[model samples]
Target: MTNRLVKHIQNLLPDFTAGEKDLSPFITTRVVKKDEILLRENEPCDALYFVARGCLYLYYEHHAVKQVIHFALENWWITDYKTFAMKGPAVYSIAAMEDSELIVINRQQYEALLNQYPMVALYFNTIHERAYGAALLKQKTYATTTKEDFYKYFKNTYPDILARIPDPIFASYMQVNLEELVQLKQSGVS
Candidate 1:
């Protein structure tokens, strides 16, 4: 699992090395069962998960209902960033959607690793930039696109997710009504 994690990181930043033995102690591996919550709203998010297998959902509750914000699949990173950065209670909850293998690293250890490995820091910065850009694109999309367009955009952007995730969860993430999603799918729009 550690080798796998190292390989995934190497894919992002070629400077990463598994054989160095320098980063081994900083990471801990865990297997999470489906539906297991890795972090909960209002709780401190002390760690970030690097997914090795399966999927996880990042969600928050609104008016007593859960709203999924994103899904992290293999080779993706998942965490409550607001809480992790601010040292405040988390605004979201993260849970395993399928039995998952993850490399869990505490905030302190992660920071240490970044400082020790400049390439890792650069890689993480790149990821942050991409995530921010995606958020900006989504905002622009919401402002400019119709519901059908939005669905189409989501389908195109996250084609893997469309095939793997259930409709209701996908609808929640897309912020579209289930009926609308059904209509779009049935009409061959998505």
Candidate 2:
């Protein structure tokens, strides 16, 4: 698992390594069952999860309804980063969309890791920037587009992930009602 983690990082960062130092000392692996809640609202978010397989979604529950904010698929990272950094309770919950394998690093090791591995620090910075940029772009696009166009954009942007997510969940993420999402999807917009 550690080797796989190293390989994945190297693929993204190109030659990323800890030299003679092993990453296993700073990381652990866990298997999450589908629908398992990894973190819930008001729970302290103490770690980051790197998806080694399967998918996860981050959402907020309002009036008993789940409004998904984001999805993390294979090779992606997921956590309430602000909460993790602040040592505060999560504003949202994260749940497994499928049985998942995750590489986890808790707050303590994460700080030590950045201090110890410059390359790892740079790698995290790069991914964070990209995610932030993409999120801003998506937010702007979603704000300007119609419900249909928004659905199209999501479908076009994440066809693979789109298929992996359940319709109701994806509908919630799109901020469209289930019936409308069904109509849009079946209306030959794919």
Candidate 3:
């Protein structure tokens, strides 16, 4: 598990090295079953999880309907950043979409590492920038792309996501209804 975590970090930052010792104490591994909620809406989110295996969905409730905001697959990260950073209640719920394994690090430990290690901070900053860029791209795609074009873009961006997650969840992430998603798929738009 430690080796895998190290490898994961290495993939993100090729120059990073904790020398096995520093990295050992920073990680905690857990297994979660399918449909299990890792973090619930309105709960405190004290930790961020790294997916070593399997998939997780981040969702929120609106008008009694759950909407998926993001899906994290293998080698991805999941967290409710507002709750974790501001000490507020979470607006999102993160659930396991499949039997999964994760490595979790609490906010305190993460901040401590950022303060103590420049490389760790640099790596996290890169991660944040990438996430922000992706969000911006999604917003741009939503605003300028036609619905069919949006579906095609999503398919091109995340080819395996449709097979890995349920249609309702995928539709929610795309901000479309299931029927619309079906029609798009049928028309080979996605």
Best by lDDT: 2
**Model 2 segments beyond 4 Å from truth?**
19-21
- lDDT for 24 in candidate 2 is 76
Candidate with the larger TM-score of 1 and 2: 2
Show where candidate 3 strays beyond 4 Å. Answer: 19-21
lDDT of each: 0.85, 0.88, 0.84
Question: Which of candidates 1 and 3 reaches a greater lDDT?
Answer: 1
Write model 1 residue lDDT over 43-65, tens digit each, in one string.
Answer: 99899898889999999989887
lDDT tens string, model 2, 150-172?
88888898898888999999889
lDDT of 2 at 3: 67
User: Candidate 1 at residue 138, lDDT?
Assistant: 83
The TM-score values for the models, in the order shown, are 0.91, 0.95, 0.92
Candidate 1: Cα lDDT at 99: 95
Q: Higher TM-score: candidate 1 or 3?
A: 3
Per-residue lDDT of 141 in model 1: 93
lDDT of 3 by residue, 56-107 (tens): 9999999988888787888778899778889888989999999999989888
Higher-ranked by lDDT: 1 or 2: 2
